[model samples]
Target: MTRSTDSWIQQLSTLMGDFYQLLAKMQYLDLDQGTIDYPPYIDPEKSVDTILATQLGINPEAIQLLQRLPYVAAPARWNHGAGDEEFVLYGCFADFRKDGELEESRDPLYASIDPKDESVGWEDEDGQYMRPWYVPLSRLGNHGVVLILNMKNRHLWVIDQEGGCSDPGLSDVDWNEDLVNKNSLDRYPSRPATEVLRDLMQKFISLEWIPGGIHHGYQHHHYKRLYLAHGWPDNFDSPAFNATRQVWEDEERAQYSAERPFQDVDRLELWTQLPTISSQLARCEAENASPAWHAQFQGGSGRIPYESRKAELLARLPGEQQRRQELLRELEQARRDVVGVSGEVRRRREERLRLDGR
Candidate 1:
């Protein structure tokens, strides 16, 4: 029960049974005596899972995909934040199993695969071997904050409604005794919201699943939480959504820093744009079935090789049909425009000949 980092980490040593059990309780009610809580950041009111499945049109399979790490694409979910510098990236510890196989084993033959060697990556927003997992140990059933994991470097980035000061963590909290209140940093979770993240980082470090992978690489470093005020850092692994930071780097960033100092979003506006957002997210998932993607994840990346290729590809057929339909529409419009132009030209010629009295 010591408050030091090393102490609690030693207690949560194993990544199996207890990890899942403890992690499961963090998502919902702690006991019957207390009230059931829900995250406020998503809709007027809805759990992260419900919002994803209902509003976003994400199926159950997609939710399961989100739970898996080195996911076909970068995964994401909705949840409330503690408001005062707190957010949840909304994934689970289950991500530790990259396809399958958990238990502090799987010594990858190679470490530090070149960023270029892998076909799919989070583009320029991650370091080597650092899978860009959109998850974390942020408070659930609260206000809102998002913690993005770059385990490749043992670092975390927090995106809150309006916070850019010293980051806070959930380590050393006595979940049994603590009373978690929404929208406050001092209020700790009765659940292990923060612990999930810290423990995962510990496992990553202990198993040497980082960039080094038991080699003399980037394994010595630990994790740190930072305010995602600007955009992603230098590089990230996985062909994920590395949204262009350049657009926000200048005017928008300065505006937030000087004026608001938080990543703000209008929920109504976002809802209106769901079609565009959903399409983009689907595309990210759809692109991950490439042979190179599987090879990188299964063949050498140290985890079990991807086994559900056909299922994933089948899921993408709808997107393929949608794309084909869009192309046909464009082709039809082009033909109509050509016919209209030809008719206009003929009419103009006839009018000139009549005027000339030929």
Candidate 2:
């Protein structure tokens, strides 16, 4: 940050950060992803931990909505796992919502393959829900930072863009001044809102937070943005604002200002039809695979009852029974997701499809 005789640059940046924080606090930012078309998504079923929410500076409401919008990723690029890493059955938590946190306050973020929660650990053969969401650590350009949270497992990861955790530059430090100079000896590191948020959030994970025990690198339960076979929601399109007009305080401000595009809220949608369709599709594969789970779909038994089916699974080895149990639990979770979508939402969906032939 160099001295511009005019102070508009600093002010404009503050205004951009404030606007996002405001929308989230107001709960007007729509985080819902849509449903009904092709590959479907379910609304978020679980709540993000309150303590975790406060620390990430993400609105808890936003997270609940985000969970509904799993990445529609098929065979998502995953590192750290072995054979079962190529996944199609489960969509992961494709991304986290902390970009705003970093810009507003320069927190020293770090990336890690390690997490404090023991349950948060994943094997190469593990399925989707067991993983957390991640954004690339390289996103931290000069000052770009991202915070990764595994709400399902209550595990947290901090990604420091610098990558040089030990040899950080003065450019990366926030020392209570607008411009942090590289060749000066003036101030100590100052605490920003993000730093405060980071410290208060460590203890709630599955294990106590200990920096020494964790590993480096990233992991995922990544889900890509899935489009519904049905189509986009009617209100998904929010009217664009005249950001330039709104934020420019004066001519000097106008010269230095550029729009800070905020994330639109239409990202979350949990309408009943989509998840039902998703379950049906997955169930179709499960049924087709039942006769051939061992050999990866040789024949088909067409989905059988739980008690009667266990005897039929191929390869009865040391972990066969446990694997079957996890699969059942995952299936049951999907079923619970579809159980109570409202009649009105269903009626509206029916009306829309009938009208549009979607």
Candidate 3:
């Protein structure tokens, strides 16, 4: 007797679920063992299946996929980085409910029509000729990319932030391409759910295990060591993985540069305040001067006489004032130097204009 392909697929899916469960346990222990971890807020007694069924009201297949992949509390908000959001593998289906009530008029034509009514025809209201299922696998900040499935079709579809579905067989390519393109929300159809999960896992490993700017957090290095100790999968070293890593690295660099301050004005302001230090010190002494201050300067009591410490502080005040005057002179000179340089630049520009006029 031979096992069918579906049987093998089912076995692999079960193994995947076990793997995710281990990953989730590791997360609870605050160990960096894998690319993703289960959300800490999830109740241990409630199975992932139960949570999905209760929260999303999705089908068994969707629950199975979520169990295999698991949801993670993302370090940053999803898409656009605007709000706190979780990255989870789950699907949503269109409900025939309106305002908390199921609308009988919107039921499937087969369910609504009478067996003998010839006038009633099959009407597809949900589109795709079947009920649509939206499965969001990953999100960057507040932005999301969801896998759209339908009962009528075996092909998987990718829907982006803009609500555009990718062309058939081009989901992976379009997803990668959109990372660099201005229209980042364009989507396409891809392989089956299993293959899509495999590909996404590969990409996640590369981004989360490999050293790069876009890696999730500082703990990635630790997870990389753990993966190595546990042994990485044979398919981990693919060209596609490397290409995706490069794309994430480039995007991370761009985001970092865009957020960085190019010119910091605070340093200039500090320099401008430097000359006032002597006056501030004098004011502090006048307001808080006491035998305690003398003792503090003398390194606790009796190290030096109070009169001697007072003389020392007084002696330092003149030097501080002198230094302040010198700094003010230097600042004035710097201003004059800047004016001279600006005049020279203007003169050179005028000379160039005169030459150009000739």
Model 1: CA > 4 A from native: 1-143, 169-358
**What C-alpha lDDT values do all the predictions have?**
0.32, 0.29, 0.40
Name the lDDT value of residue 239 in candidate 1.
Answer: 21
Q: C-alpha displacement of 167 in model 2, angstroms? A: 16
- Candidate 2, residues 1-358, lDDT tens digits: the string is 2244123223322432343333222222223422111112232223223355445444443334332322221221122221111111111112223334222221223223223335532332221111222211112323333333333222223333443221122337544333233211122232232332334222212112111111122101000011011121222222222222133224323322211111011111223234445555555554554444623332443355543454433223324445545555555555555455455544544543464445
Q: Top TM-score: which candidate number?
A: 3
Candidate 2 residue spans exceeding 4 A from truth? 1-21, 24-66, 69-143, 150-153, 163-247, 253-358
Query: Candidate 2 — what's its lDDT?
Result: 0.29
Error of 3 at 102 (Å): 17
Report the Cα lDDT for residue 35, model 3. 38
Q: In model 3, which runs have C-alpha deviations exceeding 4 angstroms?
A: 1-45, 48-141, 149-155, 163-187, 206-358
Q: Please write out the lDDT profile of model 1 over residues 3-101, one tens digit for every residue.
A: 453332333233322333232232221233232222122342222343333233333333332333221111122112222111122212222222221
